[model samples]
Target: MFTVLPAAGGYTMSENTKVIARIRRLMALGTRNSNPHEAARAVALAQRLMQRHGLTPDMLSLHDIQESVCQNLTSNAEKVPAWLSSLATVVCMATGCRCWFGWHIHTSCSGVKSVRRSLHFYGFSGRAEVALYIYTVLQRQLRADTDGQIAGYRKRRILKNTLRRRADQFREGWVSGVWQVLQSFAPSECENSMLQRWLAQRHTGDTLGNVNVRAAGKCRGDRAARVAGWLAGRDTEVHQGLTGAQAQQQITAGGCTHE
Candidate 1:
């Protein structure tokens, strides 16, 4: 005969699992290693590649970042922060690249006043930064090469297609969609709702629609401005990692509502 368990235990740690083990061996020390030297060496390759791709222009800073993280994180006798190992494993399987973003997110994703925890939960926000960098650089390259049309062809519009209330658009729901990508790169992390969704219900602009509506307020052009404020207010580290262009892209991709 078998026995029934209470809450649950031993779920597979796949891209799907958000929190594999709260009691992870190294919930804190992590893989970076406390000495800092060894952990830096392990992730050096990843940092270099990101820098080369313009993900990091201040090349030296990348080195320092590695060292700092490892120094604080690694431990000779203690288990490495399971978060790092899990993140590293996912990077190898999916991106086939090192955990450049993973490392970046580990240290940078902080300051979530209302959200709780940090963005380090997933890798895609870093990837989002990378993608935006790629998108911007490509845009610049295109402008120099062929006509604007050529650049347009290579460009991806992150703009929304009206309110994302429909099922088809819903599948590409900004929060869920981006969340899915980020989770693939990082260890199990809690998902974030698109700030706009919350702001729409919370922020109000010029007295056009509801005049003084709070929480999902009506708006004119100021809606975009308000959303911008929300993102900036949410997390500066994440804000720093992303380019202004990406900000516009994410807004356009899903920042409007007809209702």
Candidate 2:
């Protein structure tokens, strides 16, 4: 039978257990530090210790595998953009989580009622929280870019239809680029197995669904906009433990939210 161990198992801390704990702490610090140099050093030290101790991914991610939770991130828009869904996919892959669209009824302050959509993330609590935080940051960044694009289009007296099309293309390209950078960090087989088991137990009757995102770059000047967005996404500094530019800054579990 498969056994789950607590973060601190009841037994005395073995030498290897201590090493694992130390490595975990170092990694946490590395991801949270704003100082790039210190973050890099801490990550490197953690790697060295892992190597010294012959630590495997399964061992390092033990705590995560043992615990799972669901986090719902309500979308500001009732109908989420296709790019937003793609962005969530990238975040889920990077953070070892699974995501699905969900909705709840919300009543406005003025007593108006509407359906509010949210993205539900299921994974280890830390991974779910990290996924939510990263999604929020990237969502804002994408919106900001589109807003700037819209402003420029308005200055040039461009049609609203063209502006919307280009903005959508840009967001699509951005998600594609970010996916290239972080897809390698997807969850291991062991983690996936644990997650599937947890889902079966806790999220029974859940079904898989596909989000059909269109290809980017169809209209005139669309290629340029997509290229610009791809470059921006490639340059995006992912502040979490995932492999990317400036691999620092993960919110601690039960930390404050930007929402």
Candidate 3:
């Protein structure tokens, strides 16, 4: 996690930083293990070290310092979908982040303007990057799963009309099921407090808004599509190497925002 370099002039890594890095590395390895006993032991060791040092995960993971806001996870549409908001909620819960959907105005070289939908995240610097990575992975998986479901329904002649509505239902169900999967990973009280402070300091004047999704009407194929989507969402998995070079570089980057 934290690499030590010999002092070129007068600077050197602190002992506390070294210990936190080791703890983070251990925690990352523990979470990535397939064997339950080994994983438990690794995490336990990490926790013990943290206790001895009076350190928390936020300190070990560098979340207690350097918060940032990341944005421009574009949906490439004029109107944002309700499922995207739901997906953002799931990502926020899993990563200890906050998310909002907004629009971006862009002009082409020919002077044509367009409105594009985008997603934004606010949290510790690493949290936003992690949120972006998870969102990208899950969004791709959800789209692929929904496309497969729609194609299967077409082949079976089960979906003759209301295709858009049916797709929305499936996506909504998928987000719900994914939320169930990640519900237990919510942030700790300390981390939540830090997030609240960040929001209060950064978004003090921001307006509260909501995404409006039309309610789905009763129909025959609605249940089937939603069930399929729920099943797919349950099967979706996300594995991130938090200590990898790419992630480390991004986490330590100079820019405050990911763009």
Candidate 4:
């Protein structure tokens, strides 16, 4: 049995909290009993709760009684690249959060200059966490696929310029695939508007840029590589009920700990 609460702040935040709590309880029970069937049932229930309540990652933040909103900073040893920024933007949009890039300058071991890139995620705490986890997983998958494809081209004695073009093509295809998947998971219209308003309040100067895809670039890459990468991007095998430090470490280990 579950309890439903009245809506709050023009959204069903209270009701969402109760739903999420129930989901978490079910997840814990499944884990304790080591029952895969129970876990699957819990995941199904979670999906239903999310759909029925119009829940986005932002709504999950409402579960925290101490704060109405929260933010998280994930730092990497490497400088932030345009591709990473693009991926982060996609994840943020899909998870109902806002993200921006920052640099953390520090001195290296040899007293040389070093700058660590940081991705700043702002939203409800729960949403921010989920956004980061998803970002980590996607980043890992992208890098691995790109590397493997580039290596295969090199083994075939492909020209440097051609390989570069192929890499670009793979990236485009991967991004397109990820965008399609994220769109499938998009929040409800009401939740989308609320998220946009929240982002507008905090990130007044941020504006989305238009992306132009070139047909020639897509045609130049290895068709097999692009398709494989795209398929990987569409894979969504995440533990929806995981949260806090445990969830963070689980995905970050091989995913995006250092970029």
Q: What do the candidate models score in CA lDDT, each in turn?
A: 0.26, 0.61, 0.62, 0.53
Which residue pairs does candidate 2 place in steric collision?
31-249, 239-248
TM-score of 4: 0.48
Model 2 per-residue lDDT tens digits across residues 1-259? 1112112212322236678778888888899999999999998999999888777554554334332222344244434566777788788767767766654556889999875555666665466766677777777777777677667767886666777778878888788777666643455565577666554443334443444344443676687778778887787755545455322233223221110
Judged by TM-score relative to the true structure, which candidate is superior, 1 or 3?
3
Measured with C-alpha atoms, the lDDT of residue 39 in candidate 4 is 77
What does candidate 4's lDDT look like per residue over 1-259, in tens digits? 0111212222222444567787667646655657788777876776677778776545443333121221222325233333455677777666655555544455778999765555556444355667776777676667777887788778786777778667766765676677755542334454445545554444334343332223324335568656755665565333454433344443232211110
Which 10 consecutive residues of model 4 have the lowest summed lDDT? 1-10
| lDDT sort, best first | 3, 2, 4, 1
In order of TM-score, best first, we have: 2, 3, 4, 1
Give stretches of model 3 more than 4 Å off.
Answer: 1-80, 107-111, 156-161, 180-183, 213-217, 240-259
Candidate number that wins on TM-score, 2 or 4: 2
Q: Tell me the TM-score of each prediction against the true structure.
A: 0.17, 0.59, 0.57, 0.48
Clashes of each: 17, 2, 0, 0
* Model 4 residue 226 lDDT score: 64
Error of 4 at 84 (Å): 3.0
Best by TM-score: 2
